[model samples]
Target: MKHVLKNALLLFGALFALALAGCGSSVTDKSQKTASLAAASAEFPNADLLVSADSVQKSLNATDLLIIDARAASAYATGHLPGAINLQHSAFWAKGRGLKDTDTVAAQLGAAGITRQQKIVIYDNTTASWGAAGRLFWMLEYLGCTDVHILDGGWDKWSADGRPTQRAAVTRAAATFTPSVQGSLKATSARIAGRLYDNDFAVIDTRTDEEYLGWQLYGETRGGHIPRSVNLPYAWYYNTDKSTLRYQQLKTMLESRGITPDKEVTAYCTAGIRSGYAYFLLRLMGYQKCSNYDASIWDWADNTSYPMDQAPNYADAVYPAWVKALIDYHKPGSTSAAPPQYSYDRNHKYLIFETQWGSFDDMAHGWADNSYLLGHIPGAIHSNSDVYENGNPRWFLLPDAGLKTALGSMGITPDTTVVVYSDSNIFAARLWWILKYAGVTDVRFMNGGIQGWQAAGYPTETTINTPVATTYAGATKPALLASTTYVESVYNQPTAKMVDVRSGSEYSGMISGYGYVVNKGRIPGATWAYNADDSAGIYVDADATLRSYEEVKSLWSNLGIDFSKETIFYCGSGYRSALAYLYAHLMGYTNIRNYSDGWEGWSTNYVEDPAYLATPAVPGSTDGWRQDPSGRPVATGGL
Candidate 1:
């Protein structure tokens, strides 16, 4: 009875205070908002942490409904959610400032009209710019705000759906904020330094793999992350449309990375902003024991004694929607739009080719299947190897006139930008070399190929686009290809490296990798850089997508090849080496060439040194192999 009386008196006192203030039109109170979001609350244990933009739209009339725009003041000045006050989220924490005192934070938040009891919504471009709203929500939670929530999908989602926005600046009556600061929410650098090797503790670096792998990004005192940190990245949790993925699939994805409710997880980025966003995600995912390493790498890396490790590599890719955005983006109805671009000049046209051997059916699904010839990117034409090269027994580029006819028939020109991909990374690479050799100015080879496209959960089309044929000027880049004479000249030179991108067994002279190539011996001085050996699984990810820069560099370095030397790459034929050459070229190595003659020309037609062959050839070795130049290991693992 005493407790009930005290509550009644408090309620009466609140109403009395409101009566003294003339306008009490703001805020519909907490009960009304909860009733509106009952569905989300029912769907997940912590769904109330987020509120839909629809709810915010409905509540726009409430003057006391504090909506904070967690973006730059410039962005807020342009346009923001109705009545939202601009507050840059990154200002919450800083390198030199660190996490501020509760009194200081509360005073600032109160000036922004945020109180402990008011209904508040914070929003930002959540999927872009490291999800600023999430960090704001984290800060609010730490300050003991029980009625705060983030606007789901934030500004981008609301604006994209044509929701209400305003340009007028808002200044609300300042409300008193009392901070019940939660220190556990923020993990100091000292805390993480001690827990680096603890199995039960998981440290997630919420930065790109490039930054984690020793790049000195964001003014870090040193390169690389704290030792034993796993890079989950901030963008991985978002969809192509820039919304955070919710529910079971998201749970599974997180669990796969060993991030679970059971572990005391700590997330960090260059500073605290990205990591604060990460903390919000963890809490939303129902993980109770999570914290943000606010100082993160900036401070930790500066300490010389702190342990650090650099990673070898990661996958190279672009988001599927980024590609689709290029495909679909059109400006003002008055403005002229250009085609999908790979060039600085957006007006330049480009072609997507489904590079493959033999027939169109081989590249697509069988004619009888219900897939409707699926398995290729939309608007891709089947670029058959048969038409472009001398096939059946040998695979090599045709003469210039034949090449011109083959290329021109496919609508290729010196000016056209070409994109090629294949189920076999080698085939795509081979076509890439062919186009580059024929003097096509720009050609892009999708390193991940079809598997990469599929793995990204994007849709593909089987539309066999007909090329609008263009006449090609017959031209060649002789420097890209190695002639027999050129190969012999560089064969044993210390100034150049002959990289054999073949399988170990083939390099060891066990058997010729192809039926057409009868020779089993390798070039005497060729370095065994591993190849497309399916069984060996060399030079690629488990899914056969391209390896990253460091991985590729390491592979070559291990085989006596380096960017410093002029590299001449070869395989049983030229196809496999072309793939390796493509990777090197993309990595900015210009002094590289693919020898089309490969081992076929070397073993069958090269004038071998009589003394070198006269001695018994060493077994299972590159240079000392006996009679019959067998393919060592080309095409074992793909590019």
Candidate 2:
């Protein structure tokens, strides 16, 4: 049996190598398409597959080969190859599993019966399912596991050819796997901070070209990418599988676009999550000096001091032909109908205000508008968009205690019936989410914003004096928030509605950034509603005069959305989507939730089964594509 397996492996290797190499033209380029043991042996020898079913079948004997299965337990329970050990990916990366901790992973391998002497073979459903398999492969190599190989097409490929299978599970005694850290693969924020100006390092802002061009805003901060940073969107690496890249092809493609292996590269996205994936790819491709900027674009944009550069030609440049094609693909026709059941809930009533005191710039403008020493809202208290106590620049979530203090300092209290507004609807919605998370209810945003108020001839004081300091004390309770976990569970369930207010390409993953890969589709059940358009020049809906209920329902339903269910809205950082939330509130939806972290949050902290929305996939008709006065299409950059 051992001889049969060894001979088959050798034969398969020779045939595959010959087929992939072809006649003359370089073996490296074409071999990228087919699985090659030669390529594996050369770049990632320690990460190569050690055995296959062919070896077992052809040799009629097997010894010294470890077969590992990477799949969900449910999938594994159904049927897996004989002698294959199940190693689910999600389980290893549980909440407490520190991905950066190499020691823990080494110990895990040791427990999995991995050893230096034995050969290892790993397989999964496919390349996409290979996420766990790939991570495991990387980890094993890091732990000095040589003579290891990944099943080319994974289990699906094996089964496609009618390979042998067994139902019974077999357990083996654990083999010790120890890792000694060797490379500079992981990078921290503090480390990058010191190297910000180091010319030897080139930072790759792995966000959308639009974001790098300052076309869209992140959180409540302005839009623009880190200065001197090149845009090599992380999504460019993967094919339809979204798990493995054609390494040789990608290496060449990236090099042609100026990402060389010799240069020190640092990658970042909205938060560190997407960039982490990019960081992993760089290391896999033999790039020794690559690390992902975990804090990502969000952290960089948070601080005004961080240097930024906007691509000069983005606004005026003609749209890529593909984008124009996308736009023309789904132009909304007059036949589009309004939602079936859409109307505002008359039970809710509150005076929503639009203020400009959420940020230092907004605060300055707020002071200019109402020269009062006191902060904001007439009967309301102060609420900055960046209220997180830990000081994460993107104004990310904060603990209930910190939120309570921030609210208390601003005179917020339970039963306040608060009205929040800002220059950006996200800040208002973020505040609303935080308040709700902290257990304060009855919140509303000025629909038309401060502009609506001033336009409506509402009150404003220039020489405003300080008001009496009021105490705000609210308790933390379950009713107040949709915790991250709660949000995740609700999101995955078929019952919840996820609304993405970002532009069409962004929602579709055609454009990367704000923490997601391009062409990868959206959250499983998310609906896209571009942005808030009102008399206030495209501000997210804030005042009571939102789009008519008929209009809101029609807009979403035309996009194939079911309006009668529970809904959760989000955008880059919960701003524009707040307008959708306001619209839902106005439309009278009883169960409304907002993923405050929104796309930024979801893309960073959670991974969902990819589900494509059935709505129009057109560009301009959707969002992300811009039309000029002459009707020429253009790439608007960020939305």
Candidate 3:
């Protein structure tokens, strides 16, 4: 521990020094008296190559350049160019995981002394991947920061060139920056919906061709791109290995796909961040009319009213002549269709009974052969949890309103009781969490699910029953939802135990990619566990449907966790932890809450709002500081 701490401190010092030296004296150079740092109209220089540390040093003397470190906090803290402020893309942009709101972003930029007139220089630690760096540059452009440049080859080039570096944090004299809001650069959900079928604008999906065609996305939900959107994944804007693009070649490729420099082009993706990259490239290439749909496909698909053509099911549909030509020209392979996105709702009261079977199909077969098959518990619908959510990687949050609409279409009334039974409600637990998050307050997981129901000799139904749609007005209680504020508050107070169901590697923050989070660890004082650990034996009898209090106690004891503590379960996006949440409720944990945003939301953004923490102060801050644990004073080392 001592050795690790010593190394960490040394690493932190080296990073601080490098960031300071990278900034140079241009910012403090009184020689450049005409350009004021606070004005939005100040003259800013435009430079494309910012990779040379010496050039970076010379450039910083101009007072008009703003240097941004586009890397994870840990990386930035270890060693960065001088005078650069950490402008993490995940923390500064990505939506839903917090930091999506425009006002919040502007505020952060303002705090960093970034003015529209200042040339923003952004670089990453990677040799070529510009996932976060490119995203931030695009965001700055959207905010009307006209003079921005990327450091080609990023930190790798600078280090290899043996640029001067430091071992302290960079401090800057504060400068005020005023922002002028511009709406034209932003594309809202409403706007994207309006243009979905409009022929005047070309809709380009910036995800993989497979994802664009509605195949599986991120191992979570299924379905393809927006009905008619063309697949020109952001990666297509670059080389095969995704290092850099052949601008003319890419332009010609897009032109053949009906995307002309003069034509209006709009891009989308799972969440719009990747599309931001396309938006930037379009502008870089002098495309006069281009917009990135920020809400992207996730929000679009969630809105059921939005028309989308089903992606040709890869299993049954053959490649079309047009698409096949493109496939052969670039790469040979058919785009797969995503699986069905099981829309959920809180309106229906579903009761499920679980029965013993070695496989899911065997259990279904057993239920089919049983007397219960002749007649199910009145008003109960049968569904397997596996069909509802994709289990690996990260479970995507089901759109709240989509769930309501889908349930209503399924003949489920808003107030109907839903009891789901499986041998053990283990899998059913996901539905229980989905219902609650969707605003369905009256939901329960059959303790043992079908297993317990079978022990009671409950009848099942082989035939499906269709019911009428009912209007369900669910209560909107935003307070119960996890926001940045709530996460910080609960974490600080220790009044709640934040349970992480992801593996320790994720919880410890060892990830390296876009949307890669900060803090490099779980929320301080959180309890970590895996959902797979206690699921197998939770259901033993029909009466076992209710969570056995003893079982819950044993599970907690075995893991050295305290269930009596107010609980808040979370995973990548509240998917896996949901199983724990349901199990806790079964064991009678009444005060448990799930951080829907979970680590994905919390880490990507930050944990500063008081509402997020229950305590007034964090546990291990230096001298009780309120800043992030991984953050240091911005001025510990200056240019």
Candidate 4:
């Protein structure tokens, strides 16, 4: 067997040569051709059954050599290596089946001047249609061709390296090709069915997740894969750029999926095309006992007697025990621990509000709007919070009259029982703080926000609601809202703690928040109290619920923050900071205030006044940063 690491290096070297071949202008001049020949010879060598472009170029005048382009007819007609005959890969396919009949395939090859005695070289575009050359090579080998070889990097390397090309078609005199099929190299449906229960056999489905899981029916009588088959998409073998195979990565991926050399592997896909690539890779990697199920799932599914199975989709695949535990913990009603008294459930008889920040259409890219449009608690009305302030000059809270007018239009009254939620819990928290600052009592935060409600199987709607406009008697409350001056005063105070609840990236002077803040650094002397989980957006559990009270409390306690001091929280535009304020209040902190303008406020003020910028900006440090008790960052980067 080939050493795994050695094969990986070889693959990388071949890919590097192909990448270099595509640079600069084509090799047209004699000097360029001479140089390219020398470079190609040094970079690429003829492996067992793999030929280099230079070798093929050097042998173009040999009468015994026949070069075949295995790409589409259109591609071949565009430009092809000189004297190369077009034998498009599709011509080798069995009519209405995955594999061609041995006699028919032999005749087709003979018509294309492919004789058993002739030395054959095959190629296809390396990047676009993967494995075409490999498939042809496999078929030719199975037919017992004596001298067949595949171009190392196929047409891509040949054309990219500035080899000679011709647009005119090349016709070859018909030659005889004898049928000498190697039955052991191909698996039939009946053979695969009989080996299904054999411990030594492994059936690999080399299709996409959608096909393997039956999520899509692609030209099959039914969806899903052959029974007892494992899915290993062929694309996984290639690098992200699709330039070449990453052999070590491919080996690790296959091994993880239980596709090892120990088993008698039979690979298949929607058709045999992709599986042919798998067959080539397996053989090249020295997996001695492997075959291609040429008929694949297409023929297998057409027969009613053949059994098929739809494996679990990607999301439903098995996860580790710890992941399962976390998932279970976040499910609604799974935890018996009480949520904050101020957090409300879906059943609460209050006016629910969804405080999203963008236009309805912007929701597709911006997580906030998309979540609302996809599904929101049935009675919740959308609130575009951006319209509540003059954001350009500065994000200033609306005056009492403007606030009252907006609330009245939204059907909110002084006695209204308000329940707020947002996809980004921070948005909802900000709105809650805004309502409280406007002196609206009886306000409550949804414990886990809209995601929590959805996870609990609550009904959701996409329809927009038109509220019955009512007069809201606005009463401004000054204590809940902290001004910029107040935030500055508490920044380094011993009895008062200012918390920068933005992302580490935002606090570290690495990036400015939302491009509105002129400076990158945080307010000097403020502790980094943002839960690591909030880094992605807002901190939420596996099921999108807020973390448990104990979990959240521990986050602050580890940062040396407690209820003993007057706590003030701030984030970009005050949204996330408002969430921190809400959490602190729920954790029983006596005096909590939200710097509503947040980093945006402070930074904008500093930008407007050079003196504020000169006032010695705080240097950011992770010293007091909040982390999970286990020392892991709480915020995962994905949903």
- What CA RMSD would you report for each candidate? 12.8, 24.3, 28.0, 18.5
The reply for model 3, stretches above 4 Å from the true place, is: 1-61, 93-101, 125-130, 156-175, 219-222, 239-243, 315-639
Off by over 4 Å in 1: 1-42, 312-639
User: What is the C-alpha lDDT profile of model 1 across 531-616, one tens digit per residue?
Assistant: 75433556554455554444566567766577687889998778888878877775567899999868776765322566755663
Q: How accurate locally is residue 515 in candidate 1, as Cα lDDT from 0 to 100? A: 63
Candidate 4, 258-374: lDDT as tens digits: 678898988888668778877876765667788888777778888889887653222221112212233234456675322222233433334678787775756765634566677
Using TM-score as the measure, which candidate wins?
A: 1
Best candidate, lDDT-wise?
Answer: 1
Q: Comparing 1 and 4 by lDDT, which wins?
A: 1
Candidate 4 error regions (>4 Å): 1-47, 240-243, 311-639
TM-score of each: 0.54, 0.36, 0.41, 0.47
lDDT of the candidates, in the order given = 0.71, 0.52, 0.53, 0.66
Q: Which wins on lDDT, candidate 1 or candidate 2?
A: 1
Worst lDDT window (10 residues) for model 2?
A: 625-634
Q: Is candidate 1 or candidate 3 better by lDDT?
A: 1
If both were scored by TM-score, which would come out higher, candidate 1 or candidate 2?
1
Model 1 lDDT on a 0 to 1 scale: 0.71
What lDDT is reached at residue 272 by model 1? Answer: 74
For residue 385, model 2's alpha carbon misses the true position, in angstroms, by 41
List the candidate 2 regions with Cα displacement exceeding 4 Å: 1-62, 90-97, 100-104, 116-118, 125-127, 146-148, 159-162, 165-167, 196-199, 202-248, 266-284, 291-639
lDDT agreement of model 2 with the native: 0.52
